[model samples]
Target: MNFVEELRWRGMLHDIMPGTEEELNKHMTSGYIGFDPTADSLHVGHLTQIMTLIHFQRAGHKPVALVGGATGMVGDPSGKSAERNLLSEDVLNHNVKCLEDQLKKFLDFNSGPNSAEMVNNYDWFKNFTFLDFIRDVGKHLTVNYMMAKDSVKKRLEGETGMSFTEFSYQLVQGYDFYYLWKEKNCQVQMGGSDQWGNIVTGTELIRRKAAGNAFAITTQLIKKADGTKFGKTESGAVWLDPAKTSPYKFYQFWLNTTDSDAKSWIRIFTLKSQAEIEELEKEHDLAPHLRILQKALAEEITVRTHSFDALQTALKTSDFLFGNGSLEFLNSLSKEDVLEVFEGLPQFTISKDEFSAGINATDLLAEKTTVFPSKGEARKMISGGGVSINKEKIADPALILNTENLINGKFLVAQKGKKNYFLIMAE
Candidate 1:
């Protein structure tokens, strides 16, 4: 497999330095992409680059994942209007560790000749003093050259203005490339389109510092078809960490993509071959309402990011909430998992004493909780077969609910209709 061609077909190729493909084609070269530890978990925004590295390894090259522990502290000014608040060394260390662990799940580290390797820039920069960096590295690139870069130029034009710390980020990042090229024999650096300028800085640094030839490749920055930001929802970023964004929510995020976005994202994000994708596209077109493309994209990505078990749980959660899934599925979940399934739905709490003593359905829905506005409304809805408790229809408005009705021993799942749901918790 040709790495560059793989990215090209996926619409992931943004900019490539000349001869990068030829260099990659000549032999199994070492390549790397730097991931800044701005957050503990990588969001969907980072997946394009991750996919780039995955293709790189599949093409029989060594892949290096560089966690920007050193550069993260300084903060890259690329695509940012203002300087960022720096994380403490301790926090940065924790983030770097987390990022490393996450990256491990995606790439094979034990594969023989061309195994994936993780590196931290902090290892080299920690002991290197400011005087050492400026004298040895800073002199190679002139101030004019640095200011000419779009990232620096944009900040210079902005009202907030760039800081010395951020301005020197490219130099730090460049040094990282030069160091990797010299020590690890890593011949290529890849990233998002925004990193084109910074990536070139690395190539230039290698050229001037060691008279060595290095290459750069950048993938397209993902964007939604509607022009809204990708990887974000009403809650915020869709994180890879299951703790931050539950597996069910993460699955739903991809499952809910617009048709046009799913059509494009499937190519960029999934490892499905061109033939398989074409077939899926055909199947999707046959029944657009079924959301076949979105389901395929969501399931593969969710399973890869989390696990097959997690994907099953997410699917079961979806079925329970949206389809005719059984109570056994809900009963199987832990308290945390149950809460995760009910996230973003309306919830109310009633005393355990009152719940144990048994309350009438109308009273429970109207007085004890706000599932209904009033007893009359609750009775009307119940009598009309519009209300359900624990997945069973409430046949009579006066039906008594007690400890026996509590799911997982502490909660009742109330459905106002086919769609709206409420969680009534016994405190």
Candidate 2:
């Protein structure tokens, strides 16, 4: 399939300019997607655009990943109720570098003709003065045309009136497209559905200013089956950076997708053939409990974003936490690994001096931690075979836990029931 057809089948194509597919089919055109550098790390929400650029390159086209260093300073007002607090130059520069690094992971930079290229709008905008920008680039679009955009119109209707800095964002972004088109021979701009206005502005500018044609293609903005936002959990956005969101948690985010969402997401997120997805759906329907679709989706994305080794560790950690994984696995891991395995579990801390002298298990579970409300409950649970320490059933409430019981000399794994896990730390 060609680039446009591939996106169409994947349910990614939302809007396309009049001659986009024809233009794409005619030649190996250079296309670009702009990524806003609002944060140091791009989250899972950015994956669709990344996938778009990847698909573009896979179809034998040059894909340029543009980090919006200058446009980011004037935040895109799309889908916003009020103006965002602008980032300082130092912070914006840092965020730009971080986003560029993350963008590098998705596209090939070493291939012959279609290798991906990275650019920052700041590179071009830094030398151009305010006067130069308004005179050369800003004159192409009218104030009435800019105001017609839904992003601007909505803000104009709302109580938080728009700022000149933000209102001028589309013009700045339009100039980016013109700059890339004039300098890089970039003929197409791709983005999410929300960017339709800004993208068309670019195409419009290209036509009026440079008297050249440009294409615009936008993909569907991702949302959940329930109509809530995608890429968000109770904790926050599912970040691509392992430090921000661990591979295990990242894997879990997709692994826990609803069946309906999984069917759609598996296609949009993964480069899996349609046949493979259809087959997986068949298996999933046969035994919904198996969650084959979710697993496949999670594994592919996790491995691509993180690594095979990271995915393996995430799987091992998941198995140990949720499956009938052996305690030996936990024993073999270091304290750091153990903590990662039990991350977000309820934890209690005690001074090492107190832990040096043996403490009664009941006292430790009750007074020292919130694992149990009182000593009586701890005693009863221990007698009832419902309590365990390091996967070993606690047979005696009188048993004393010392430094010897501490895994890696600083941690203890406590269980109140089969699934309720707590971590005790001695520092």
Candidate 3:
């Protein structure tokens, strides 16, 4: 399939310029998608634009990733309620470097002529004086034209009104495109549908300033079928940074997707071909509860965004913790993997000599740990067979915790009923 057709099937195409397909078919063209440097890591919300660049590069086009170092400092007001806090230059530079490193994982920067390249708008905007911008780039678009955008309209109508900095955000972004177009010979700019005004401003600027023809494409902002914004969990954003979110938690986020969202997500997120997605869809129809789509989507993205080893370990850890894997499975984990997967599990810290010498089960589960909070509660729950240690029932209130009962000679897995888990670690 052609680039447009591939995107159409993948549910990616939202708006394409009039002659985009014809232009793409003639020769390899350069396309770019801008990303904000608001944080050190990109979130799942940023995947849509990344996928668009992936598709563009896959179709033999050069993909340029524009890091919005300058614009991000001002913040884009699309779908936001209030004025944004400005970022320091030091922080913005750090964010740009981090984002560029992440982008390298997906795009092929080593390939021939169509190799992907990274650029920063701050490079061009840093030295351009205020008077120079007003005379050169800002003269093309009228205030009336700027205020007509949905982003502007909402802010103007709302209680917070708008800041001159936020209002001028599009012009700054538009200048990024113009710079890329004139300097890099970049032909197309792509972003979410909400960026249409800013993108068109670039095209309009190109026409007025350089008498150049430039095109723009915008993809629909992904949304959950259940009506929540995509890329958010109750805890907050699903970050690409391992330090912010572990690979296991990241894997689980995709694995836990509802049936309806998974079906659509696989198309937009995965590089799986049309036929492969169809087969998975059929497999899903046969047994919707199996959730093959969610698993596949999760696995592909996890492996690509993280690593194959991470995905493999996540699969093993999930099976060990929740599936049929035995207690020996937990015993086999490296210290790091055990701690990573069990980061949120309640933990009790105790001296090695204390646990090794002798620790009473009831006291350990109560005074030593936050699991039960009291000796009476620990004893009552243990008597009812509701508390389990290392996947086995703990019934004796006087039972001792020792290396013999420890997994990997250092940790104990405590479970309360079917869901709650706690980890007790020897210091």
Backbone steric clashes in candidate 3, count: 0
Instruction: Give one digit per residue, the lDDT tens place, for model 1 in 181-281.
Output: 99999999999999999999999999998899999998889999989999989989989999899999999999999999999999998999999999999
TM-score of each: 0.98, 0.98, 0.96
**Compared with the true structure, what per-residue lDDT tens digits does model 3 show for residues 268-332?**
99999989999999999899878889999999999989999989878877886788768766666
Identify the runs in model 3 with alpha carbons over 4 angstroms from their true place: 327-334
The CA lDDT at 32 in model 3 is 92
Give the C-alpha miss distance for residue 252 in model 3, angstroms.
Answer: 0.7
For all candidates in order, the CA lDDT equals 0.93, 0.93, 0.89
Once superposed on the true structure, which residue ranges of model 1 sit more than 4 Å away at CA? none
